[model samples]
Target: MNAKTPTSPVPPYPHPAGGWGSVKALGISLMRDGAPLATASALRKQNKPGGFACVGCAWAKPAKPHLAEFCENGAKATAWELTDKRATPEFFARHSLAELRGWSELELEGAGRLTEPLRYDADSDRYLPVSWDEAIAGIGRALAAQRAADPRATVFYASGRASLEASYMYQLLARLYGNNNLPDSSNMCHESTSVALPETIGVPVGTVRLDDFEQTDAIFFFGQNVGVSSPRMLHQLQEARQRGVPIVTFNPLKEVGLVHFANPQSPAQMLTPGETTISTQYLQVRNGGDLAALTGLCKWLIEADDIAQARGGARVLDAAFIAEHTQGFGAFAQAMRAADWSAIERGSGLPRDALERAAKTYAHATAVLGIYGMGLTQHREGVANVQMLSNLLLLRGNIGRPGAGICPVRGHSNVQGQRSVGITEKPELAPLDRLAELYAFEPPRERGRDTVATCEGVIDGSVRAFVGLGGNFLRAAPDSQRLAAAWAGLDLTVHVATRLNFTHVVPGRESYLLPCLGRIEIDQQAGGAQTVAVEDSTGCFHASDGVAEPAVPTLRSEAAIVAAIAQACLPPNPRVPWNDWVADYAKVRDAIEATWPDVFQGFNQRFRDPGGLPKPNAARERRWETDSGKAQFIVPPPTEHESDPSVLRLMTLRSDDQFNTSIYSLDDRFRNVWGTRRVLFMHPHDMRARGLAEGDMAHVTTVAHDGHRRELAGLRVVPYDLPRGSVGGYFPECNPLLPLQHHAHGSHVPAAKNIPVRVKSAVA
Candidate 1:
């Protein structure tokens, strides 16, 4: 199905600034709004026995056991949570839901923390305050009514912000109610990586430990902007750079943070106005060209290894490891040799010499850390892209070794945790078996809806009630207008959020906005202060608590909210200990321990330490988990197709200044964008091809196979140093161009990164 994209109807602001001026403007705005005074105190308290978890990115690296454990974004996240602003019942009384819906997402949520449970009243076109009991009862009634008809009609989605206990309860409650349709934010982002990783290895997440970064001889950064996408990781890269480790960066656009960065922690550098030069060399690749680049690299390596082998010398490839642990090298080798250099160079936007140099570098490095992000995943061939990267790593025996493994940098702080705790749409039998053993409930053996499927269900009238843990579902979904309309069509809708957001503004037939305590807020239950465990990308789970009082007196923790709903909806399900689990989060941890042994032993006791134990990465010990007990090389078949002559491959990206669906401000200083998120960055030649100049307004139109047209206009075209035929724009705003139906093959994740669109000069 196709949805019409919005016409840039009117320029967000005429005469928009470009170049360094835009960068300076954004920097000033960032310093003004991004600086946090309470971050120090909050971080200090974070180390205390009951400090809250970070509400920011889901990198669950423990806030360094002592001192403040926060990056710049973490500080902003803390400030965002502890802000004095409040969206009280009185505020809702002043503005009707209809009026609020018209407000920009930035304005609607920028107001502040939601302080009460709100129920939308059609007569008043506004949400009126309701008691917690009343709201829970309403949700329970909605679920009961819907379940009585069709259990699959209800969509229960959880976001990363929900605690481990809370997410567990959410799944439990949904299963008890007879629906396993748990479509969470993980599906929209890293679901592809999660799905492919396990097939390649035995686990779904990255295998690299932080310690490995220190020992790595070389690192490859792909399609990720460390400076903006993950700032905390920049320090680690800086350290590696300082050690003189060679770093090769591949991206369509040259990110400033990856080029040179000034670390706040380096005193000598701070005094000397010094900067850490991150990438020894950077390769400008085209969007959706990652597979091509990987193939070229592997091709060069195979040639080198063959030459060495003929000379009766050690092969450049990991011959011993490959012989012991892989199955498909023969097939892969043939594909690599057959891959054409012209196609690789044209598709990747890199010269053959540059590709060879990168290949030589990888061949020389004793250990290499390969890191990739959404740019590789958001494409028609995202899964293939991952499999190809896995092949590259395996060729040199990069897996099951120190300082080497594929790392998909997750965005949310506990996103990895959410997946670990069973918030996935596609539940693995092993995890489900463990869940059944721990909770004593036989979870439905049937499959469930992913993000795209859930949206389709909603649109096709198959989904009745929509309950979201903490995401901006409508905004986060592709085709915002269709998603909003479908959401509005739902029989009942519930949102548990810490702050006000655009999702809260859109009303359902029976809509409820339940304000939940933020990560920074204290969650004092009947059992007294409680700490929740969160798992990081590296598989380390640790406890987090809160120091400050609840942002609002009426607010409840996600655990409490989930439990209350479960108690109210499911009719006394004797299969699970719902009440006990929600009361004391420890009970939840106890269950987690039962499900996954050894890793979470004395789960509560281990959390007391400043350092948490890292989970096992088979690669770390040279134990390959693939079928042959070794890393396997996969040579994907080439797509015998040509790019549309009229369109270019456009990648939708997040700005350095914003998080997923959470727009702090309209300033992307890293990209030199200020006071706007509507502009598109492209190469000067691409702009010239369309008769568009820098700062010239243009219309972006997408051509669907069904002859439907989706377009956005009045977007100021800015010439960037990006690869030709490649373009980049901010997400959500550009989400409309991505069809909900356009997703990866295995997981059905929308290709938000690789969209083909034609550009033209805007009329007038």
Candidate 2:
């Protein structure tokens, strides 16, 4: 294996997920965070009904909680936030912004939590400490000035980690200021699901619960690596396997997690030195091939059902359910039957027999659940891809039934919750009338800029002020170089953050980094130690109260920060009660209930229950809220993006050691790549075809249809098990190659998963 750096020798990891390796990783995290005993105690409280939820992936908590419900990645998120180290004013005094910009992502965050609010000093190019009052006043003044000109001039960005209370406060602040410019982390990941699911199933969220895994007879995973992205999910998969459930995985790369997984918590498996096989069948589909694969499955199922009906056997198609609970089935079935097998095989890069076998499994199963991740959602046809999955489930009467539904696995802990509580660019979807009546202020009704629009706004000088609640916006977004430049051109940029990130250093004319409490930190307000609530991927609303003492005493909770800014910018409003809401988080929940009564009624009381209340989803009751009053079968045309023979389809992936833009380590332990992130994974055949071999340094250039080429140099090409004409690279580093304008059709999510690129040996 070729390593980009010489810090350590690259060796393939032959073991499965979560065994001695996970234990070792946890030990390293504890040592690095400098509080093993405290961290250990804090870990025990994670995901407990009485404690905080894991700040990692939003996998639903098990009904029967274990002593150690957290996964390896969960421990990393906790340790990263609860680190004993502090980045005080003195630390900033020694490091200039220019110097810090050159530092790695891991190095900047590892410096530790910000202990005070800091303002950018352009002359010194260093961050200087500013009082919280002054910081709020300055930001308030800037926001007010921007609103005076045009509320659309200001862009409010929220990270998925933010609690529902903070998310509501942020969105309310933006809307009250007369604009709906609320673009969140969800736009970059699962906006496709948000767009496609409602059109097909009349609801955006998954209908399945945590217990659904137990009852599911078959599980089909598409483009999702659960073992690495959501390790806790492996426990459910392992249990399902034990119950004779067949798991099928479709991904571009043969991820080890999909092949097998070993739970460290299971003493029998750990002591006996054996692992449970995860995926019964693994299909290495081509990048952006999910649509084709799903179409093939549908075609095969339709054929099998026709044969079954002709033979007077039990019908394979759910005729009764489909006839009664669905629309556009005739056209959908006709399209499926007419789908070309050669095209499906070519597009999916899988044989006809493979898809037929998968379809057979689905036809035989009583309950089938389909799970997908960013891989399916981060494409030009992302929305179509998601709808295709929904079509498959609807055909089998899988939806609105026990153990069966379409699940779009989210990366962030509360991204789903953020959307539920009104963190969106679309104003019509928000409960504006209810909010207006409660707050005595008219909310904006016009649709505002999304992530892509926000970037364009900043670049075109339309957006003058930017307020990021809790994300590395510049780095996480595509076209990093241009986005950073546009961000720097802003009049003001306010970031409510716990630690340093790439966005903090890319200062606007007047920038402020207001330190805030992390998920693991105790948020003590005037009323009491407040507990913030988050809705999981499965729509379960739960309270997460931090167990560890805050790393910095001066750090404010995200809710308080938003409220303080709102109080400073907006006029004194007796109805709003900003001060009271910040003083007690329950007041925020009360406001949410009043605004969204149907979903959040009795929120405060229901939140107190050990097991959190599940948000009411009408789809669970076999109710369709669409125009047809039934589930719609959307038959999208075939994927139109033609593959270039000379170009490899490149997809951005997260290292096992990283989450979003936060790099835990350069080493991607699962992939066996160590000490560096500037490496691209390619198939051996593809490398040979390109005259590139292992250890050869290559330059990757994006082949954009608009003729705007983007390139990344000095990337080491390493051989992997990906399909031919497909390659993979770590995100943020390869994000530069992604064009900001090149996004999904309806969702506007940057097509980060499918980039047509050509890789060649570096000239140097």
Most accurate candidate by TM-score: 2
Best by lDDT: 2
Q: What is the lDDT, from 0 to 100, of the residue 732 in candidate 1? A: 82
Tell me how candidate 1 scores on lDDT. Answer: 0.76
Clashing pairs for model 2 are none
C-alpha-based local distance difference test score of model 2:
0.88
In the order shown, what is each candidate's alpha-carbon RMSD? 4.6, 2.4
Compared with the true structure, what per-residue lDDT tens digits does model 2 show for residues 1-764? 33233222234468998888889998998898777877888998999976898888999876678779999999998888888889999999999999999998999998998999999999999999999999999988888888888887888999999999999999989888889999999899999989998888888888888878878999999988887789888988999999999999999987878888888988887897888999999899998888999999999988888999899988998999999999999999999989999999899888999998998999999899899999999999999999999999988899988898888888899999999999999977898888888888888888989999999998889988999999999889998887887778899999999889999999999999999998888888899999899988888889899888988678899999999999888777788888888889999998888888889989999975655778888777889988889999998877654556788889999888888899998998899898999998888777776777777889998887766668999999888877888899999899989998779989999999898888888864
Which 10-residue span in candidate 2 carries the lowest summed lDDT?
1-10
What's the TM-score of every candidate structure?
0.93, 0.98
TM-score, candidate 2, is 0.98
